[model samples]
Target: MRYGCFLSEPQGPDAIAGLRDQIAQAVADGFTSAWLSNIFGLDAITALTAAGVQAPPIELGTAVVPTYPRHPAVLAQQAMTANAALGGRFALGIGLSHKMVIENMFGYSFERPGRHMKEYLDILIPASRGEQVDYQGETLKANVRLTAPGAGFPVLVAALGPRMLKLAGTVADGTVLWMTGPKTVAEHVAPTITAAAAEAGRQAPRIVCALPISVTDDPAATVERANEIFKIYGQLPSYRAMLDREGAAGPGDVAIVGDEDTVLARLEELKRAGVTDFVGSVFANRERTRSLLIGAAKG
Candidate 1:
């Protein structure tokens, strides 16, 4: 399994600052890849493209870029451009965002997300791969081909349920997950996606599992801190179902918090449970956790 580090949530100048040094540090510290989120501050593709050119050969990814406002063509173009910029090390991770955010925040219909995702990937996959895609679906239509890409990039769908996961396995390269635990990954996720890929005659798909990590001297306090910070995720319907599937009450319940050895053991369990790419959203004991994880990656 490859180890990736989620870029720390930026503050103040990070919005406009170049990420070359930060990315270099991750590579220097032994991370195989790095993930950036698509928040309001800086777009993931743009940020990664800017920094990726300067960083070493380590991989760069979009933890997720939302697929609501942007057209598949536009996103595909950006993703292909970023891939070229990264010398083919970019992984495009996209998702259907929550209904509340789409409707309330963006004023778009959050309608039939599973179907929407299927339609979105239909256009996105081919078009982003330097192939012409003149397809029309219920939710979207695209007539485009990438004319100037250095190379093709892998895709990772942010999938949760069976329909979404099946789409991810068959249509896309793999799935990039958040807050999904080993129990669900082992019994439900791994089996479901692997079976779908095998039936479709595709190679084993990448299951990139992202989780909050903290190498802490105080596990209880760290868990409580994570609870306060990530509780809102528990309320989101999509995330709630994943949590329920794993029998986790809140984000804190799934957080891998402890000292180095403890966190390492749990991470081993995840790998055994079929997580091919492990991205840690480090929280408490930042440098300590990062340092320990860097060793874990190296070892």
Candidate 2:
């Protein structure tokens, strides 16, 4: 499995410069890829593109950018443009987000998220490849072709459920997961997506799993910190289902925590479970965890 690092939001005055520094560090540390989340802070693709231009080339991707707010065609155009700017090192990861955020916060209909995503892909995939689109589905409509140059970057979906997993496998390049454990990925995630891809006659899909991790002497204290810091994920419907599938009481239960050897063993288990890429979110003991991840990548 390819080892990646989750680029946490940068602090201090110049956030963009800080992000660029982080990317440089990732390259220096010998990581295969680096990811950024897009919830409330910076625009993930734009920020990464800007940062990536300054740093040595390393694969950059959005863990997820919400699809409810942007039109698929526009997003495809933007992503392709960013990819071209970054010398084709960008991957676009999109998701439906949560029902509450879609309806209550963004004032968009969350009635048919699965259908929305399916239709969104109908427009996005072709448009990103510089093909003409004339789709009119139940949830979305697109009738334009993008003028942006096709960089041929992979598109991933933040898919957790069956419908989304099937869509990801059949249509997109892969699925990007968060708050999911190894058991769930082995039994439910990998099998479901791989079957769909096989049925569609597509190449093996990439399953990128991201999880909070810490290399600490005090595992119990780290678990407690994770439970408190990541409490919200346990309440989200999609993540909650994955946690339940893994029989995890909360996000902390699924977090990879322990000494270097233990954490490495857990990562190996994830690789055996068919994870193509692993992104570590160093929640605590940042230096120790990062050193272990870099060593894992190198070793």
Candidate 3:
């Protein structure tokens, strides 16, 4: 099981250089991959492009960029360019973002997002392969081709529900999961994704599980910090259902917290649950940096 690190672009007045240094350190520490979140603060693709230039040999990717914000062809071009800039080490992870963010913030209709994503992939995959695509779906339409061959960048989908997982299996290289626990992964996620791949006669899709980690003797405090970090996700119904299935009272309840032994145990549980990769978001303090500690564990 490969272990990786996941972090957002740093938050502060002057954060770019600091963020680059953090990415460099993760690469130097031998992490298999490093991911950036696609959110309001920073442009993930740009950050990753800069990080790729500074940190050679580290796999860089977005955990996801929302599909509603950009057309599939545009996203394909951006991803191809980034993958080339990164020397063919970039994975393009895309998703249909939350309805709240899309409908309220971006003012795009969020209904039938799964269908929209499926149509998006119909264009995106072929476009990434440098093929001409003439696609017309209810929500999207495109007739485009890349002028040059893409870097053959792997596409991962941010999938949670059944329909989305099926689309990922049919079209994408893998799935990137957030806020899901080992038990729920074993009982729900892995089975659904694998079954879909099998029905399609495709190879089993990669299952990259993103889980919060905090190596602390005071597990309660660590959970508190995780809750604070993930408070917004708790309010979203999609994520809330996943949390409930994992027997979590809230988002923090699924977080990997405790001493080193306990944290390692949680990680092993994920591995046993058929996770192809583990992207850990380490929450730590001034006294004990969980990122450094968990990075060391990869060795």
Candidate 4:
């Protein structure tokens, strides 16, 4: 399994510079990849561009940037620039964010998100490949051509539901999943996504699972921290349904919290379930982070 770390774009004094330092530290710590979360803080593309200049050889990616926030053409432009700045080591992970985040936070209409994403990809893929896109859909319409030749960055969709997974298999390079447990990944996500890819005559689609992990002696305290950090997801209907189907009562149940051996065992369980990549969201301690990354790299 490939090991990575998620850098939160914390908003405060010198946030962008702090992000650059964090990315540099993660790369120095032997992380294969460093991912930036797309949210209200620093724009992921800009932050990554700065970090790309300071960091060497570490792959950079967005955990996800929501499709609702911008048109595909716009995203394609930004992604191409960032990828170029990073010397072609940026992965663009796009998704339809939750209704509350889109509508309530960003003030966008959250109607028919699955359909919107399908249409969005239709434009995004072509544009990211530096082709002209003249497309119209219920939610978005675009007519633009990329200025650069092409970034050719791999695109991963943040997919969960059946239809979206099928779309990712058919069109995208892979899927990026969060908060999904091993059982659901094995029984529901892996088979369906790979089957769809096979039906489309494509190679097996990549399954990148982002699981919150912490190597802590105090497992209960670590679980509590996970619960607090991911509490908002439980209230979101889509994520709630996903967790329910996985037999996870809450974020605490899904978090990987234990000693080094236990955490490695859980990660092995995920790999056995067909996860191609593991993006570790380390939240317990800096020492634990170093231990997990070293262990994962050696493994």
Candidate with maximal lDDT: 2
lDDT of 2 at 296: 91
- The digit string of per-residue lDDT tens for model 3 on 1-299 reads 88778855777865667667877877766778889988887788877887667765778879889999899899889888888888888888888889989999999999988888888899999998889899899988998888754449889999999998888987788899999999989998889889888888989999988887777888898798889988988889888989989889887899888876777778888889989988877666522545544555465
Off by over 4 Å in 4: 10-13
Rank by lDDT (best first): 2, 1, 4, 3
**Range of the 10 consecutive residues with the lowest summed lDDT in candidate 1:** 9-18
TM-score per candidate, in order? Answer: 0.97, 0.98, 0.94, 0.95
Higher-scoring candidate on lDDT, 2 or 4: 2
lDDT of 4 by residue, 1-299 (tens): 67788887767777767777888877777778888888877778788888677766678888889888787898999999888878888899988889888999989888888889999999999999998889988778888889874369999998899999999999888999888999988998899889899999999988999988888899989888999989988778867777987898888778888988888899899999999888887777757656876668756
**Ten consecutive residues with minimal summed lDDT in candidate 4?**
286-295
Which model is ahead, 2 or 3, in terms of TM-score?
2
Cα error, candidate 3, residue 225 (Å): 2.7
Better of 1 and 4 by lDDT: 1
lDDT of 2 by residue, 38-107 (tens): 9888999889988899999999999899998999989998999999999889999899899989999999
The order by descending TM-score is 2, 1, 4, 3
- Candidate 1 lDDT over 48-119, as tens digits, reads 888778778789999899998999888988888888878889999998878888899999888788878888
